[model samples]
Target chain A: MMFYINQTSCISPQEFILFDDNHILRKATGGKLFALEPNYKNIPSAQLRRMGKAVRFGVGAALPLLQQGNDVNGIIIGTANGGMEDCMKFLKQIIEFDEDSLTPGNFVQGVPNAVASQLGLLSHNLGYNITNVHRGLAFENSIIDALMLLNEHPLNTYLLGAVDEISDFNYKIELLNGNYKQQSNEGTDFYESGSQGSLAGEGASMFFVSNKKDAAIAKLEFVETIHSSDEEEILNWVEGRLGSHLIEMDKIDLLLTGENGDNRVLKYYTAIESIFNNKISIARYKHLCGEYATASAYAVWLICELFKNSKVPLHIMKVGTPPQKIEKVLLYTNYLGEQHSLMLFSKVK
Target chain B: MTAIVVTGLGIISSIGNSAEENRESLIKSRAGISKNNNFYSRYSTLLPFGEIKKSTAQLMEELNANEKGVTRTSLLALHSIQEAIEDSKLTLNQISSSDTALIGASTVGGMCLTDQLFIDATTASKGSEYLSSYDCASVMLYLQNRYKMKGIVNTINTACSSSSNAIMCGARLIKSGLVKRAIVGGSDSLSKFSINGFNALHILSSDICRPFDANRSGLNLGEGAAFLILEKEEDCKGKKVYAKLSGYANTNDSFHPSSLSEDGQGPFLAMTQAIESASLDASSISFINAHGTATENNDEVESVAMRRIFEKVPAFASTKSYTGHTLGAAGAIESIFSVFNIINQEVYSSLNYTSPIEKTGLVPNLNYRKTSVQHVMSNSFGFGGNCSSLIFSKH
Candidate 1:
């Protein structure tokens, strides 16, 4: 099943606009890459004050698209850790005050579904609303659901997105867990650094998906998540998907890999690269967006840009030359060698 | 399109540990809400909770779940899912097949270790073993790894309606031909995090909860897990067919973050749309398992919505009075109770009910009796106005 990406928006550590030659590459500082949030002047001041980082970035990225006079039939969001700051605050208060005299503000905002719910309330979309909280496959699951729903409705458009924010407490814990790199590296050099850990990052990316192709920028060909650590099994699964879709290796113009500079897991990507046989131009994105569960959302956003601009950004291209006329792109990402996901996108003809 | 049918059912709640035991408890009019004995919280003594009579250590020992970073939430889920798979007679090959999907839901997955997490984050330079199991996805991840499930695995967290949406999503997956079978349900264990959170909200009842009663107080928190195996009707050759998933609909109220609208717009739309999707008239519904959290706002709003949807409201009762509002697991547990209503051809009484609310003057069924139940509707509403209604019918 294929659905069209009619409109899209993203808020990441890089600039919000499309990349240009003069665009400065933003690098991680102190092993953490935070989202470059837009000024949420469009949202009400009172409401803005009550929103958390994830909610703000999610809603801020989606509100402009929704304001363009499109009636969305559903709102689906994916997040790994939702409203961690608020949750941590509530937990601290409970421990401090002994669970007494505590308010309900943080408790309500800390739920995993808060971003989707806030989108629903703000957009007045009473239709199907849900949130997916799977680890690295969170955003991919959301897209799968949206496509299935589009298949069911046929005429309805859906607002689909993924958002995650880094909280100070969670960052500290993850750092201790050895999930992030101990030393900071330049964004462009992080992938080749062969470090033990990846930089911690956060972002939000939203899209308007529908079955109709009118005004579409790109078409989603396939999406799947594999739960295997065996390199041979993962390779076989990817081959099976390509064979099922009848997509030849030569038809794919670019291969986007989610290499987060974690040396231990770089072998998985090396195995995937063998399948393409070095024929396809390969690019990497975790350097710019950092490594989080749903960083695939940013990858999709970059694919949209590649198709819209008909050029691959030089900063992201790692191997081979940039495709002169981009048509099809395949994305493969594995998180900590446990969760593997593959997505294919094509330019609308 | 082939109909989706439930082939197996498993439940562990305050009432019982299995489906048969739960039914027996309900028939005997035994309410499970009482003072907490296993969970240690500041409100444990002052308030009543429908806590299962087993500690985390006991559950771990019984389930043989000695894996690192395993919390009570995952243990409860493992207990029920094991029963469900065994009851369905699914072979190991079928269990590991890519055609079977697992959709789990939870509001408090590993947050049950909030105290441990706080202590570790505050003092320990190196994170503890519990660090890997601290997010909402840990429960499902643990289950997926344990079962070796290779198909689509996803977790939904729409608060109270989490598992109902899980069931609904599983049904959709089957209907879309994405998978042939889906093991769907949810589990939530008692935690100081949730107890204190609900206390902060001022919705925890000190005494036993009395849903639909005029002077009903708030709800009592509970913990448990329930899972139902759903397969296409054509696929279940000789299995025990419990109920057919006929209809389901999810709608947001777009109102307040915590409260429903005065008119219950979300509930009304969800119920009506579910009925329409089932291609049945409103009068065809024989019983309704209401969301009825026994709160000042939920019971009244749900009542208003039921009245608006059904001309002569059918026999309806809130099972939360029995299970004490098991947040994420409430939908699946209540849904299994609804299936029992169809399978046994009987209705269970709503305990601790005296009078109906003055506004709607609605009265729930008060006695256990045999009846002809054809179709049953189950409602679950959660925070952010996430309301969902599911309809099940006799197979």
Candidate 2:
């Protein structure tokens, strides 16, 4: 049994939008590309007070849209570097203080699941809860958990979310590695050309998933996660999955790839684009949101939106006419050469 | 329609080194928790834990795996996974390396090594090798590379629910026909990072934790590992079935980021869903293995969750009072404990309890109790409102 997306929110370099409520995103932050901060103070000052950047950003995005008159059956979050700031500090202390002279506060919040745990505490939800860290696959697997749980327990709605923060150590590493792409030209009076690199951006995206479809914006069709990077298997699997549907590859309108403007990654996308050709709209979101392990989480969020709103924002485009009605979108991503995930979504009109 | 069957299990915790040892210890009401034995901590006067008595080096020797970079955590994991994989009657090398073998190695893995690695990242070239050990997912990759696991190798770090989620993910894979078999569980070793983390929150008890007790001080931080072999039923036909993992559910309390909601709503919902998934009534739950970290908030909230759902909340006990909270390993650790109790038809005592909490008046079984139990429900709740409960039934 497939679950439906009731609502979603994403805090990224792009302007915030309810994931399923809107479709088609444009580069709204002037291509200046910065983390999208939310109005946490608006809901309740106290809740936002103790929240670190990760908590504030995640809750600020999901809590609002998931206000469905009920506590979600579960909250599933995947963070690549959860409170590494606290963890790093704790590590520094253990090293300096010789282990005995330390406190557990930072260490307590250091676990990857801490993000989802704190959210549960604040919301007073004591249900099935989990936080997964498979890098980019984290979000994909979290979605899989949410969907699987819904299938097992029909009424158990879920808040499936992912948050990645830019840490000094990691951010610096990306820069030296040439993965960050911040262009030098005058603002795009907007010409679309594929780039070779993009700045690393970080944010949290959450979806209110439920068995209830009337309120759903779209249906999460199929999600596949593979460890080997064998392009042959990936291609065969993709085409095989497509064959299982009533519609064929030609029916797909939008294809999203996890290209952070890195030439190597872009080349991977080109390989994919070459396969799709001009038959489908190809979009690279790394320029808009940068690259983090779970960046395609935002890609999945945007594709759902594009299908619902029937337009693509100028910020995430390469080319092609905006479709009148979108039917299918495929989200593909890879992280550290270990996990490559592909998620297929179908509009629920 | 498909069913999830738990065929093999393995564990290395404070209470026991294997499933039989754990069962015997639990039946005797023997507690594995004591004062921190290995780590030199400043809070020794304020916090005690379910720390393993053996040193990390000794544990490595016990496993005969000193070269595995021997964090007591991975060593513990090696013991458990090897047992589980063997119990499953399957070998990674025999499985064609083509079938996806997903192992959910959770924990802030290698935190113990992190302190040394951090000091070395700046000090020596040998230290750089430890950098790969820092990431939790790296543990799975290391194991895959070490054992040549031909299947999908992955890690899930869901805190206390870590191993439970790992088990759940693996079960789903088998049930959905996505994979042939999976080796899933969690591994965590005690370290100053976790020991003191609980201390700072003032949640660590000075003595052994007394879950559900009014006098319960807090949890005794402990560390260890646990795992299970989840294979499709067709493949496990002739194998001994330890228990049928009937239902499992995970929920996030949107109430707070750290503490559970007032009514323990998330846990209550999770239990309800898990029970429903098993297609059984709450009455069928002959015993309940509570997460019972023994912290005031946990005891109160979890008991409230139990009360809200179980009309007669079957006699329950928090084995944490014995093993200490093993962080990520608690889920699998306790799951193995539950199956052990089910097989033996006994409930372990919730050691070191003086009285029951005033709110629910729920008292964990502090004395060994024997009963013909058919199904056992186990719960694990964590920070970030992460909550999960699973139902294990006798075959």
Q: Which predicted model would earn the best lDDT?
A: 1
TM-scores for all candidates: the values are 0.99, 0.84
Clashes of each: 0, 59
lDDT of each: 0.89, 0.71
For candidate 2, write residues B61-152 as lDDT tens digits. 77676563445677778888777877777755654354656667567676666556555433423333344455676556656656755455
Cα-based lDDT at residue B140, candidate 2: 66
List the candidate 1 regions with Cα displacement exceeding 4 Å. none
What is the per-residue lDDT of model 2 for residues A53-148, given as tens digits with 9 covering 90 to 100? 666677677767655465786678878767665677677777687665476656765567667766665565656667778665778778777776
The per-prediction CA RMSD against the true structure, in angstroms, equals 1.1, 4.9
